[model samples]
Target: MNLIDTKNQLTEKKKHVEKVANVENATFMNIQLHAGEEVAEHDANKEVFIIVRKGKVRFIVEGEPVDVTPDNVLHMVPTERHSLHAIEESDILVIQVKP
Candidate 1:
């Protein structure tokens, strides 16, 4: 089994959001976002599953914003226009299934 501690990656970035693929040959990734930061406006390349771990997140889906907090799982369909904001120093895991 392949395991990773999401917060312990040595390459973790200090600014903005950062992502790293942890599973071997699997279309999954672990993403981290800094507090008060925003991933403004982007089109999804695939169906993405977002899991919030530490803080809160707000997602803008098709112009409507939804609040996502810790322990929340969010899904976005392929090619959907969306954006995300970190409410309070969030840690999110994004799995891209159809990229």
Candidate 2:
């Protein structure tokens, strides 16, 4: 089994993105963002699942804003265009499933 300590990856910097795992069918990433930090718009080339681990974030998907928090999970189709803004200092786990 593989274990990851998500909290240990938190950073004081504006943003941090790290690949934690890459298996045959999926890739896992840990993203830490300070309050007000933003990830620019981009296309999701593969199916995606995003889990907010701490604080909150606003996901701009196809020009629509969707607020996400630790209590929720966000999914995106491969063709979706999206961007993220940290509403507060936040930690997020992103999983991309390969086709």
- Candidate 2, 29: how far from true, in Å? 0.5
Per-model TM against the reference: 0.78, 0.92
CA RMSD, predictions in order: 3.1, 1.3
- Compared with the true structure, what per-residue lDDT tens digits does model 1 show for residues 1-99? 656566633245653344565444336665566777788799767788888877888999999998887666888888889988888777777787764
lDDT of 2 by residue, 1-99 (tens): 978766644444558899989999999999999889899999867999999989899999999999999899999999899999999988899999998
State which candidate has the highest lDDT.
2
Backbone clash pairs for candidate 2 read none
Of candidate 2, the 10-residue stretch with the lowest lDDT total is: 5-14
Worst 10 residues of 1 by lDDT: 8-17
Count clashes in each candidate, considering only residues at least 3 apart in sequence or on different chains: 0, 0
